[model samples]
Target: MRVRVLRVLDVGGLPRVFWWVWVSTLVARTGAFVAPFLSYYLTRSLGHSAAFAGFVAALNAGGAAVSAVVGGVLADRVGRRGTLLGALVASAVTLVALGSVHSVGLIAVLAFLAGLANNATRPATGAIIADIVPSGDRGRAYALNYWAINLGFAVAMLSAGAVASHGYSLLFMGDAIANVGCAVVVFFTVPETRPTSVGVAGAGHAGQPERAGTLVDVLRDRIFLGFLGAVLVGAVIYSQAQTVQPIMMGQDGLGPGAYGAVAALNGILIGVLQLPMTSWMRRYTHGSVLAASSFLMGAGFAVPLLISAVGHPMGVYAGSVVVWTIAEIGSTPPQMALGADLAPAHLRGRYQGMSTLAWSVAGIVGPLVGGWALTAIGASAVLWASLLLGAAGVPAWVMLDRRSRTRVATLRAAEAHWEPVLSAIASPEVVSAGVPTSEPEPEPV
Candidate 1:
């Protein structure tokens, strides 16, 4: 058992920079008290309606979406280190300011700004990992990062209730302090990792002209766009655990404590099993793992239908949580790694930012849709809808995998087609004839 644990935790051969990033992430997430309890703070502490609370949350999500794009551009242009440092500092300030506001309108505005600052760091962080870690080690690196996030989140959730009982101000202040600490770590340890123009040119597709790294380039990538759509759907389905699941459970007579326990189970399961699962999943393709993840997530939510029918709703709900937690564990690392893998060196930050944008959009859309579905269709329909959405991702990923393989094959063929010409140009005889003698560059694999 000890040996197994050691093997699971052994993310060897990664750079020292990656470990510091992991550490900073863990610290930041551990102090992320506001997001988990945002709704409660609004509805209970701030004397707002549930609808108003939802609106504020949506505003925050919108801010995050917008900032993700901006952050990506900044990371690419200004450098990853600077973008991350600015984001952390800005987030810390906003969080502290948020702790003092009284007016609802002001609070909403502050929440948006806070979210913008908080989420702006994501793309830079992801880009740095992709920049430093080799492709083969990326899955483990991302998995370890995920593990750190869950571990921190578990600690946050466990402590949040106790802290909130005193005053919500403490929660915001704690989060602010943590964000500042994260910034300090980045300032002292993390370095700028954005690739230079020459490096970008060398790492791009061979035989294709170098293009500027921009949103236009990302939007033109059909395979990545499809993957992003699928990510949106999956994010919506996953979002229900926070938005709809607890409400439905409450209506079914489960107490808030029960919901809290179930949510805690999610964090604990991910924290415990993610590393081992990542190790095991290394044998599978990203598509296969994602496909299984989608199915499990759908099935987990759908299982409640059967269990509720049999009058054992709580038991079934717990079981469903287990299933979906496993799915989350399986899907997240590979999905993150795939984004890094698919991106060119120059556009890595933007690609990761686009992925973050998908989740942010889902954050806005999921609750609104889930709430309407619950009101218009009923709980069962909502579950079925979640199931369908999860199932839909399976085909999207399969298609993405197909398209990616086709692109790689095409690139390889292009390389083959260009090789002889390049060789001939590089030959001494050709050089003597005044032709250039540069070696052929291989396209990014």
Candidate 2:
């Protein structure tokens, strides 16, 4: 089915924002390509074992999880552009620092800091896109951004392997350079999005000051929490690609080059196919889309279990890549879009941040479980764990789907019931943190 090109620039002057988002996604992902190889470098070059590598990687993921939430809050309070700029610069510095470290302990600490900085920009980026793009066009914008990110990742992963063949140090240095270069571009090009009264920051004024919303206010919304729960389930499975797959494959005789190739394949599918997939999926209910995609993703993860030894290991690993890519095409963008959808008009950053936080936690924890499974049981168990998590997502996804639909229904009833109340709250505009003061009190006759 052919989809019309929905433009994201109804408000005007947003082309530059889109360009910056595209470039930033590319550059950030290029730097991110080095992440998958970190464990390999530590274990193979520095002589650490898989378990030790898992611990180190876990620390980085843990840091990223913490920073993601903090980044969201700061972006809502400060501005998206500034928050993104800071995160990009910090990540670049940390990646460079990571290259300089030789001690195992030091590397772990640096890795955590790097992950934190790397992930912190997520909410800010999402918020910026929400701020600039019209709602109708936001999905396409996000899909395109997702494509740029995956494209860069694919290139980076392939390049990392080739560069690492020369020297692992070279890969790290290259990633840092790309990160810094991207940061510079973002600092100049990405406009700051301020919070608006409705919860969207910088909706009208780019530099206008907005009061931040209380965490309590953001959390109390049942719809937002429901969306966050769904995201967390998906994130747990997604992190396996970065932290678990390499270790599992290594045990089965697949080397970094092969693993990187798999990553490259995953990237290609996402970059090339995600928009098309999202376009088709957008017509469906978001809940159904998420549930179907989650199952596919889980199926992809399970397929890798068949391969044991190197040299393709029964060809299942290669096949699994295709399956996983298909699942990713179904899963990732919709998840981002859903999070954006659930956030109140003004509070995209907080909600996006919370989603990132869930991902961060999953990133930290998934590998720990996979690592233990690999150490204690075998690679097969890792697949089992992924499958279980994927299966577990079904009930929550159903709950969220029901809840989301109901919220839309209830919004109408609430609007009618509290029409007067809402008016009073909006009168005089009690602005805090750039967000609108609160819901209005019913108006007096």
Candidate 3:
């Protein structure tokens, strides 16, 4: 096991700049103090209703949806490093500003702005990894980056729970500091990774004249759009972890501390198991993995209802957490890798941004729906309904997997030019994305 783990990490020979960027990601996520607990703060400490918190959270998501497009454009145009650094600084400033406001109306607006700033860096971040890491290593590179995110999240949840008692302001202030730290690291260490395809749209590969792509062109892609639909559903299920899950626990009389501990299990499990399981996860098809994730998440969130029926303690919500954590481990790395596969080299940021858009959009829809359902139908019914949504999403993904593989095959059949991104997809065990239409070949230097 140890040897396998070592090979995965060492084979990448991930550059020093990559580690610096990874460290920055860990720092930023570790300081993401307020997001996980925001709904809780609104509902419990501020004496707001679940529905109102959902509205506020939705507003935040709305801002993130807006940022997703702008950030992607900026990353490809100006450069990844600059866009990322700017976003980090803005995120920090917004967080500090958010800490001082007391009026609910003002709070909602600031939350929106914070979401914008906080999420804007995502496309740039993904672009940087692709720009830096070799094709064969990008999958494991993404996995390692994910591990950092969860590791940071584990520490944040633990610390956030402890300090939560002293006043949410402290949490906000700490988060701001962390954002500043992330920005500083980026400015100093992470370099610009925007492809040379900056000016001319779809001209050629990375080293040639810089190309640009319109958001319209990217949106027109039927295959990517279909995948986005699946991602949107998965993102909704995923979003429940922070917003609805805690709201449900609060409904059941569990406090921040207990919810914190239970939630920590998610980050903890991913941090520990994601790397070790990456090799195993590579053995499956993308559609199968995504479909399985959707089902597991639906069932996981509904576990509380089953446990309750069996007279189990509601506190054992850990059962639900475990199932979904497994799903998360299975889905995230491949989901990212596959997006890279589907995109043309020039439109990488916009493509990635659209993926972020799905999550941001899910954030908007999931909370409002989850909140309304919790109020009207009750938490159990709302959760169990997730299973139905998952069931609906499964077939679409299966068909999508087939169609996408076919698309790649068609692209390869022609004397089409190969992009570095596509090369990675053709590697042994084919871990990255874009299923190989023919036998694997060594990527050209």
| lDDT leader | 1
Model 1's alpha-carbon lDDT is: 0.80
What shift in Å separates residue 148 of candidate 2 from its native position after superposition? 1.1
Backbone clashes, candidate 2:
25
Tens-place lDDT digits, model 2, residues 325-355: 7777766666776677666545667878888
lDDT of 1 by residue, 287-392 (tens): 8888889878887777778855688767878988999999898888888988887786667778889999999998888888998999999999998987887888
The collision pairs in model 3 are 196-210, 197-210, 197-211, 198-210, 198-211, 200-211, 200-212, 201-212
Best by TM-score: 1
List lDDT for all candidates, in order: 0.80, 0.69, 0.74
Segments in model 2 whose C-alpha atoms lie over 4 Å from true places:
1-16, 44-52, 103-106, 165-169, 197-211, 242-261, 304-313, 373-389, 406-445
lDDT, candidate 3, 271-356, per-residue tens: 67888777666677777887787788778777778655675445468888999889888778777867766776567778888988
Worst 10 residues of 2 by lDDT: 436-445
**How many Å off is the CA of 93 in candidate 3?**
1.7
